[model samples]
Target: MQLRFLLCLCIVGALAQSDYDEDDGAEGKKDPKEIQDPRGHRPVSRGRETYSAGPAAPPPISGGSRYRGRPTAAPVGKLVLEKEEQPDSGGCNHMSEKMGVLCPTGCDLKKTVQKQERNVRPTVDQLKRSVDELTQSTNSVYGYVLDMTTEVAQRQRVSEGNGLLVGQYTDSLETQHAYIKDAVDITFPQNIKILQAVLDKIREKIQRLEKAISAQRAKCQVPCKVSCPIPVVSGKECEEIIRKGGEESQMYLIRPDPLGMPYKVFCDQTSKNGGWVLIQNRMDGSVDFGRRWDDYRRGFGNIAFDVGKGHCQTPGEYWLGNDRTSQLTKMGPSELLVEMEDWSGSKVYAQYEQFTVQGEATNYILAVGRYSGTAGNTFLNGATELFGENRTMTIHNGMMFSTYDRDNDKWIPGDPSKQCSKEDGGGWWYNRCHSCNPNGRYYWGGSYTKYMAKHGTDDGIVWMNWKGSWYSLKSISMKIRPFFKQK
Candidate 1:
C-alpha cells in the first residue's frame, strides 16, 4: 500500500515539470524570419536584382525599412540596397567597411546562381559540338569527293554544250539575217518582217527567264549576304541590317581526288544563265564540298561551286532555267527570307537576296553572287566554273569564328565580334564564338553558347559538316590557307 502511494506522488511531480518546460520553450523559439548563411551574412532578394550581404550578427531595422503590410518574401538583404548609401554600422553594427567589398557590380547579387550555371552549360555543350563537327566533316568528305568526280565527268560529257548553245543562238540570228537579205526567197520584205517579229517575241520570253541575272547586273552588282546572326535586340524590338553581311568573303580550297592536291586558282569566268561559284582547295590533302550557306536570316541557297585552293572565278552565265518557290522567315526587327533553287543544274546553284521592311516600305539592300568551279574540264583544264552575276554588295559576317581540324591538328580563328560578348572574362572571337552552333553545328544562329568563360574553347574552334560540305569555324585565325585540286 505504501509503494503505490509513493508512485502516484512521483507522477504528479513529473507532470508539473513538463508544463513548465513547454511554456518556456515556446517563448524562446526562433522568430522564423532571421536566416543564416555560411558567409555569416543575411541577403535579401530585392525585386529581381539588388541584394545586401551583411555580417553574421543580425541587422537592426531602421525607419527606412518599408513593410508591405505582409512580410516580404524576398530576403532581407534585398531591402538593404537603400542602406548601401548609409554606413555599414547602420544595418548590422558588427559589419565593417571590408564587408562593403560584397557590393555587386551592375549585375545583381541575385544573379549569382544563374551566373555560375551559365559557365558550366557552354563548356559541356562545346565538347559535344566539337564531336559532331568531326562526324559531319567525315561524311562531307565522301560527298565532296564524289561531287568533284561527278563535276569532272559532267564537264567531259557536255564539254561543248556551252559552245553549242552559243553557236545555236548565233545560227538562229544568222538565219533571220539571211531572210532579210533574200527578199526573193519570200518575194517580199514581209517574210523578213514576220521572222523579225517572231524573234522579238522569243527574246522577250527568254528575258523573263533571265530576270534574276538581268536585274542584278543592271545595278552593277550581284546578290550579296547583307546580314548574319547579329546580336539579339536589347528589348522585344527587332532591327534589320542596313548593309551587306559578307566582308572578307574570299576563296577557300579543297582536294577532291586521292592523288589530287591543292592548287592556287586566280582566274575563272562563266557566261549568261550561269551563276556565282567559289571553288576552294585545302593545303592538307583532303576535300571539302563546295556548298555555301548564307546566314539563316537571309537564307540564300546553294550555288555553283569551284572549291579548291586559290580558286577565284567571276560569276557565270546560264542557259537552263526553272521556276522555284522561295521561303521566308523573319528574325527580330528585320525580316529574313530564304530563296533556294527548286531546280538547277549539276553545279549547286542558288542566290542570296536581302531586303528590309519598314511599315509598308521595302528596300533591297544586298545580294551574293554564288557560283562553283572544279578542275573537271579539259578546255577549262578540268576546272568547272559555277557562276552568278545577279548580285553585288559588300556582305560580311565573321561566321566560322572558330574551327578545329583533327587532320591538321590546329585551331583557327574567325571573327571575334560574332563569337562572344565583350563583357565576360573572354571577349569575343570569330572562330571560337560565332561560326558553328556552340554545339558544333553550322552557324544557323539557332543554339547559343552558355556563360562566357575565360578561355571557352579547348580546341578553340567549331567545325560543321553542312549539306555535303565540311566547313570550319576557327578560333585563333592564323592563315586561311586553302588549296585547289590538280585532278
Candidate 2:
C-alpha cells in the first residue's frame, strides 16, 4: 500500500513536467513559413537558399565542447523549415535549453523527415508514366504479327486453286489422245483395202492392152501403126513395094517407119521409075477442100479406087493429112512433084529437089529448094508472078500454112482483116492472097472472070504462072518420092 502511494506521486510529477515543456515550446515557436535550419538557413522550397551541410562533424571527445554529427550529403527533395534567429555562440544552446539535454548543433530532425516524404511522391509518379509507355509498345507489335498471318493464309489458298486447274488440263489432253488413237485404228485397214482394189483393176487393164498389141503385131508381119484400107501386107512405102518386085498401080498399104501407121495410098509404080505416093489429087472436086484446121489436119477424103497407070482416073479428090505428109516427106531426102492441067488439055509440072513440110507446131511450114519444070517458080515467088510485086512473104516457100479458122499469114491489118484465108475460102500458105491456090473452090467451066471481078477475090484453083489468076485448073495432083530410090 505504501509503494502504491509513491508511484502516484511520481505520475503527478511527470504530468506537471510535460505541461511545462508544452508551454516552453509554444513560446519558442515561430510561423510555419518563417522556419529555418539549425544553421540559420531557410528551406529552398520556401524561396530561400539550400542548406549545405559542408563537412561532417567530428566524434565527441572527453572534456571537449559539445559536438554534433551531421552527414555531408544533401536531402533528396525540397525541404520546408520555419525561420529562426541564430545564437551568438556556436554550441547547441537552443536544443539544450528546449530539451534540457546536451545536443549537437546544426542538426534538424524535423526537416530531414519532411524532405524524404517530398522525394517519395515524385518517384511514384515517374514509375506510373513508365508503365503506360510499355503497354502502348506491346499493342503495336501484336497488330503487325496479325497482318503477316492473314497474308500468308491468302497465298496458300491461291496456290491450291492453281494446282486444281493444272490437274483438269492434264485430264483433257489424255482424253483427246485416246480418241485420236481410236480413229486411226478404225480407218487404217479400210484405206489399205481400197488401194489394193484399185491396183488390181490397173493390172487387169495393162494385161488386156498387152494382148491387143500382141494380136496387132501378129496381123502385121512388119510394123504397122494405123489401120489399112485393104489387107495388111509387108510394105513400108510405095518405094518399098516396088523394090520388092511389086509392079502395080493400085491402092496399097504403106508404112514409112516400122513403128508408124499402115495407111493406104495410090502407088504409081509405072511413072518416072515408079514408087510415087500420091498425097493430093483433084479432078472433079468431089470432096470439099475448104474445111477447118482440124479437118485438114486429119484428112477428109477417101482414095481407095484403083488408078491404072493414070491420076484422077476415077474422078476423086483427096488430101493426105499434114501430119502423115510430114512423116512421109521427112523419111529421107524427098522431092515434090506438082502436076497441073488447064482447060486446053495442057499439062505442066513443078518439081523441087529438096522439099520438106514441118510439123503442126510450126503450122506445117513449107521448105522448098531448087525449082525446075514448066511452072515458073510461082510457089516460091508468088508476089512477083501474080501481082508483079517483090514481096518475099507472099511466096509459099518457108511460109506457114493458114486456114479459114487459123490465120497464120502475113496480111496487113485493114478492112476485111485476115483476108488471105477467108477470101480464098480454103487452107494454104497464103500471104496477101496467094499466086497459086491449089486448094481453092472448083469451078465447072474453069473460067470465073465475071464472079471474081464482082467479088474482088480470086477463090478458084488458080495456078497463076500456069494460066493466070483468072482461070481455075481442070485437074491437079501432088505427090512425093525419095530423091534416090531405096534399096
Candidate 3:
C-alpha cells in the first residue's frame, strides 16, 4: 500500500509541472527582435499554433487559473488572439491610458471607426444640401420657362385677332368701292347729254336777238341823210340816236398814210373801237407818238416803229401847246374839222361844216375859216397841225404850203416902218395869194412841210411860220372812223 501511494504522488507532481510549462510558454517574456504593433499588441508568429479569442471560448470558472483574468470578448467580425499580459512598458501603457482601453491595438480600431463616422456625417450633410440646391434651381428654371410660354401664348392670340379684324375691314372697303364705281358708270353719260341739249337751245336764242338789232340800226342811219355837222355831237338828240341804234350802228373808217394803200386800220367795236372812240376822261399820262400814229392808221397800236427822240418832247395821247387857249374849228361845210391855235397867245376861232352838193360828196376839205380871240399885231403868226399820216394833206386850196420861191430865202417886212417889207415876200404863204399882207414874208421848212411835198405826205405833222419865228399849237380835236378791209 505504501509503495502505491509513492507512485501516485510522483504522477501528481508530473501533472503540476506540465501545467506550469504550458503557462510559461504562452505567457512568458518575448524576444527583443519582435516588434509590437502600434496598437500595443504582437501578432502570433506563423510557426506557432495560436488560440483564437473566439466566441467559442468561455471564461474559466473560479479555480486555479486556466486564464489569468476574464477573457475579453473579441472585437466583432475580427479574428484576434488574446494577448499575454506583460510588465507595464511605459510606451504601451501610456498609450492605453490615452486610448482609454487595456489593449491599445483594439482601442485604435474603435478610434478609427469613430473618426470615419465623424467624416461621413459631414459628407452626408454636404450631399443633402447640394441636392436641395439643385432641386430649387431646377424649380426656378421650370417656372421661368412656364411664364415665357404663357406670355408667348397670349401674344399669339392677340395677333390672330388683329389679323381677322384687318381681313374684315378690307372686305368692307372693297364692297363700297365696287358699289360707287357701278353707280358712276351708269349715270355719267345721261347727265352729259342733258347739259348739251340745254346749251344748244340757248345759242339759237342769242342768234335771233342779234338779227333784230341790225335792222333797227339800218333805219336810224337813213334819217341822218346829211353828214353830222359837228366836231362832237352832244345833247339829248345824240343820246337818243345812240340809245336807239346801239353799238351795231356805230362804224369806224380809217385812211392810212400815202392815201389808198391797203387798209391798215383794225376796229375792235368791243373795246372803244380800239382808239377811235376817244374819251377825254380816260387819258392816262403815258403816251407814244409812233404808237398813236399806228393806232390812228391801224386802229390798234400793235405795229411798232421808231419815232426819233426830238419829234416829241414828252409822251402823251395828245400834245397841247404851251399856250392854253386853242379850239377845234370846222374848216368847211363838211363833217371834218381842223385844229387851230395861235401860239402867240392869240385866240383865233375857225368854223367849218359838211354838205353834199348835187348828191355828190366833195373831197373832204380842211380850210381856215374865221379867227376869234385876242389878236396880236402878228396876224395868223404861227400855226401847227398834228394829225396822223393818213389824215394829213399837202395841198391846201390847190397851193402847196411847203413850196417857197427859191429867189428869196430870207424874209423882209412889207413896210419897213411897220414890221413888213416887200423884201419879206419869199415864203410860200406870202407869195401865194392869201388874205394876209402881200408884202410880208412867211417862213416854212420842216420834216412834215418839206418832206411831205416831195414824198406825197406821211406822218401828219405841220409847222407853219408867219413873219420870222416858229411856234406850236395849243389844242386839237377831231373825229375819225377806223375800218379794216374785208378779208
Computed on alpha carbons, the lDDT of every model, listed in order, comes to 0.30, 0.72, 0.34
Q: Candidate 2 — which residues are off by over 4 angstroms?
A: 1-234, 306-315, 383-393, 413-416, 450-455, 485-487
Cα-based lDDT at residue 284, candidate 1: 16
What would the per-residue lDDT of candidate 3 be over residues 91-166, giving only the tens digit for each residue?
4342243233334354444554465556455655666687789889999999999999999999999999999999
**Weakest 10 consecutive residues of candidate 3 by summed lDDT:** 321-330
Q: Residue-wise lDDT of candidate 1 within 1-487, one digit each (tens)?
A: 3564465446544554555455447757544444223243333423232334454333534213333344335464444443433444434322133334333333332344354445545654665586678779989998999999999999977877888888999999999889876866665767679899999999998988799677768876655652222122111111111012212223223222335443211111121211112222112112221111222112122222334433222212111000000111122111111111111122222122322222111111121122232211111111112122211100112211111211110122233443232211211122222221212222222222432223343211222212211222321111111111227
Score every model by TM-score. Answer: 0.14, 0.49, 0.21
lDDT of candidate 3 at residue 74, scale 0 to 100: 52
The local lDDT score (0 to 100) that residue 345 gets in candidate 2 is: 89
Runs in model 3 deviating more than 4 A are 1-140, 198-487
Better of 2 and 3 by TM-score: 2
Tens-digit per-residue lDDT, 79-176, candidate 2: 53423444444553554433323243454334333444465446545655655666677777788788888888888889899899899998998998
lDDT of 2 at 239: 80
